[model samples]
Target: MPLFVSMTAGGPPDQVTRRAAHPVARKGINDSPSKVIPTNNFYGNLMLGNQNQGVWTHPYSLRWVKGTGNSSSWGFGVSHIERSQFAYGPGNPNKYFIAPLGITSIILSAQELSNSTALTTDSLEAFSVNANLAVSAQSGPLVTFPLVQGMGFFTGVYLGATALIQTDVFFRTLSGPWTLGTSLKYKVLLEDGRTWLFYVHSSQGYVNPQFILRSNTTIQGPSGFRGSIQVAKLPEGQSNAESWYDWAAGVYPVTGATFGTFNNGSASYTLSWQKGGDTGKTLIMWALPHHIQSFNGGVGAAATDVQLYTTTKGQATLVASDQWVMVEKLVTDMGFTPWTPQNRSVTTLPEKAIVAINSVASSELNQDFAPQTNLDSMYFSGKGLAKFAAILIAVNDLARNPGLAAAGLSKLKTAFNNFVQNTQKSPLVYDQIFKGVISTAGYSDPGADFGNTYYNDHHFHYGYFVYTAAVIAHLDPSWLNQGTNLQWVQTLVQDFASPVADERFPFSRAFDWFHGHSWAKGLFESADGKDQESTSEDAFASYALKLWGRVIGDAALEARGDLMLAIQARTFQNYFLMDSSNKIQPASFIENKVTGILFENKVDHATYFSADIECIQGIHMIPIMPPSTLIRSKAFVTEEWNKYFSNGRVDSIPGGWRGILYANLAIINPKASYDFFAQPNFDPSWLDGGASRTWYLAYAAALGGCT
Candidate 1:
């Protein structure tokens, strides 16, 4: 089974695969105490329960082992000795005399592997033996036995009781390596008052290994040192018959699992069983070598005449479906037959099981909630469409469950129709001149003052709805949102075409600020006073105008919105992205001394809401900007959508729901918005009255995959 038997001088080089690690959650600001967490705990402590995340393989053994535990033929990628049957002897011309007689080998190349060449080496190096045996034993004859004893340092002796039960030479190495030696030991064992004679052969790389010894009635044998009574050193007062045999100094690199000839030929296979605990514990070693699990399990060894290496599994195993795909690929590539899917699920690890389950759950939820009746639930906004759309946009992941994704799509389509129908009836009538009367929280008593303005800040409500619907439609097209259904959207978008007189919505009023008299900040900020309402009006309105332009896909619409944005940007400069300089004043008309007009942050949490109005509106004005801009922007509607995950869970945001009613102008369609909002954190419990309704839809969508 030698991998290479070519008389050719040089062969193709080994293939190297480089994997780029994906960006995981990096260590941000640590809020913990001063105790250092061991990095290794990241793996050792990670329990896969009784299951596993599945495993992958590197290139894999393309060649199949076509038999059972004992007799099998691994044609391709076989070890060097497997193909050659001859051993390299003193004067013998043949190097292949009985050579193919090992289970594996430690084949090396011209350039000995530098111990420091690799960064992530295995822990076995600290031990006494190299587990893999793939090399030309510098010693003599090819033969191996169960390790009986190992003692001393260099010039150490390794006792191997051969099966022949005859006196033979034992092996030892002092200066160079452990190889075949030309000496033997007499082992005398007493049984039932009778003395016995036994001859033991030895092997060593440095000495001639063609000698034997005879045994007598001496029954006691020293188990500690095999003639290894001293350490290696230059003798000043030496008086030995063979003073040249100085013991080796302390062994440098301990090779605890040193593998010589497995004693099994290339045609011979081995079946080694293992349990947890200790050095050779199978599970401990497997888990310690996380890189190994990436491949299917097992210590994958390579042994060709030209090369000896190790490989691992692939990435697809984490997800169950891909297991069969990879297995098929293995079969095809190896020119061997493939394995049937069979009972793979039973064999897979726990990680894969959990993943499969979660995938199904998310899928079901999306499908049931996405259909027509599903949208009928109070998913739309009475106060604003944008607000509702933002909350409803997390249907995409559900598609993994075809039923849920489909149902959700249908539901959203019906909801979209209802929106068009209702809006067409009223045509989104507006009483202009910055009325400031539309209380997004709902129809308030005449005295309850809120942001009831036809200004820039109010426009933030528009992007929410349109964006949600657009995101939904992008994932699933069942929501037919063309024609008159979009008229209401166009009318609201028209407001963005002109800059309003009131800075509350158009000019720039509220930011994530700290005004002394009336501090109103980002959606999640602590509102300190009354007039805090107007502080964010310009920001929100600006947000709406830009989004409207993009969804409408009209250059004039975009231009109109951009013009107003430019004016708002100039006016709201200090309110959001201030120069941190002079001019700490109040409003011209109301000299109420706005103390903390802004709260800046290196992280965009606070500043983003303040300036994100521009990013959102800018994208609307120019639809070519990156999508991340829209997702990251703190446009009013966008905030509502993000609210699903704000508390680390998905659900409708009560405070923002009303605003959703009016923000439909920004959505590409109904389904579009839903898809985008349904991120990994989506959950039905987020909504108040719609809890049961959303859950029902989720059930329908996930294709009855609860089990």
Candidate 2:
């Protein structure tokens, strides 16, 4: 019955094009110093001016201070925030949480590197940043630091340079030049009473490279040193932790990358780090809570007690291994289900239900297809298209109204063609600077449409259009060969979820494989690092990718979507959607039921737009699609509803938020949700612009609400 069944056989679609230029003018972005690597990544701070913003490597935050902060010299500063250091908002169960910054424990620098020195970064991959410290702007770099996320040690690869280690905390006592293999290890006791381990290794051979104590605040390395210097913070009383660090000292991860594969209902991804020294030696790495929970048998034994609290992701355990294999069971069964909790290819609804759904669909089809004003925002325009597409799907599939479906599909094509033709008020432009398709609206006003021009929330904004295109193409497969229709949608997907690093777009721009989630923030400097607000929209983007992949027969894309969705479901349950039994978040904060806005340095139980309980909780529940039930599990939904919106509390919140909460409630109590929406006096204003009454009714009825 499918039009392009052969395309769905294997691999990605052969005709999917990767365009380097758009019809609109190219915004000149020639400021990038390193042209080889992608600009927008986890290590983007290294490319920005002065490069002072901290890049979060979980359990630790590293910054290229350039001699401005507490270290009082040009170097990289390392900071770790403890549980006691978290600043909380008012109330018994705090409303928000943030970790403090500028608390540097150690500063790794060189005698040749100072205020007069210059810095440039290259080889910017997904997880590593190579910072080259030079004597001046014209001279070559004397030392390079391969800064990587989750690395147990801060290593500096010297090319005939002198090392200068300094700290604001001041040195209290220094112990040992103990020889472990080819590394000379030293234990430093700081004024803050923390034990710091330092290791030095040489390329020529095993030789003691002495570090002369310059003062209470500075330690100078041997002149013209050509090897590596590694430093790490150890637990106060854990002697065993020191041995683990020493065992993995000589080797360091120069670059880190990830590869994911999915088969049947099981999916796994391997996070690998390429070692720069002593290739045979095992590397010491820190694993976040999510990593520790899903790690396979490939990793070595973990130092459980020797842990550090990440700014937002809870405790990060130390793993004495290089590669981590994380496996997740994908939701392979979910697809275009009409309105059921269980996935189905076909269903026969009751006559009365069909009649009601047809009437609602007809009414929705007659409304305006696209917004007449403010046509610039891809986010709003895409929402309009998706809303009508859902109505069309309901009419044809659920209501079995062929005439109405045909009428709606015609209007949907006209509306979608506006974007394909690039005739919208704010047309898209290829930002040569960031190498992504972005709106021109942000060019005139940087904050317009939630910073779309500046590369923020691309996944959330473009996902709706991608889903709508998939729906239209599913109903009319002939549309795939139409003018720029498929290419336009594929461009959006490549912008946000490109599987490979190409010449135009970066690989996986929005989705972060490391965090098990997508970051909404982009191209902006934040002290807390990247943050994502709506977990539902994040999941919805993945859902859209899955559907788009299915329609175009890109098996890899579909598999990635399934893997991402499965990983998100696992992580959201662990971190964001907290039940009573969760031990990952703080004991007091878990009572909030949901984390509203999670930043790299804080977990704020409030939305940026409003602090109202409905907005904060409902933000995670909008556009309750099929995958909604997967991510927002019945247990989590029940717990969240009972805590925040139970006992008639939801009735008082009079807005679209009320509808979202009820729709989400269908996961647990479908009868109650259906009854509320089916009320004779149901107000249309309660529904969001992106939602339709017909789909909600069908959704509820299919989930056993019509009984």
**Which stretches of model 1 miss by more than 4 angstroms?**
1-406, 423-444, 447-457, 469-483, 496-548, 559-574, 577-707
What's the lDDT for residue 64 in model 1?
Answer: 15
lDDT of each: 0.24, 0.77
Worst 10 residues of 1 by lDDT: 320-329
TM-scores for all candidates: the values are 0.26, 0.93
lDDT tens digits, residues 1-707, model 2?
11111222212122332234423221122225324244346676665545687888777788776777555878777777777777888886888778887777778787877777777776777788787778876777787888888888888888888788788778888888899988799888888788788898888674778887788878888888888888888865666788788878889999888886677677778888999877899888888788877787655344345687777787788887778988887776677654333543335566777887898788878887767213768777777777787777777777788788889899889988888777788878766555777887776687888888778889899888888888898888999888778778888888888777666667788888888898888766676777877899889899898888988878778888888888898889888988888888887798898899888878989887897998888888866887787888777788888888999999998877888888787777878888887888989888887888887877776676677
Where does the lowest 10-residue lDDT sum fall in candidate 2? Answer: 1-10
Please report how far candidate 2 places residue 627 from its true position, in Å. Answer: 0.9
Candidate number with greatest TM-score: 2
Off by over 4 Å in 2: 1-40, 204-206, 300-306, 338-348, 372-374
- Candidate 1 lDDT, 457-505, residue by residue in tens: 3334433344444544445543425544344444333323222212112
Clashing pairs in 2: none
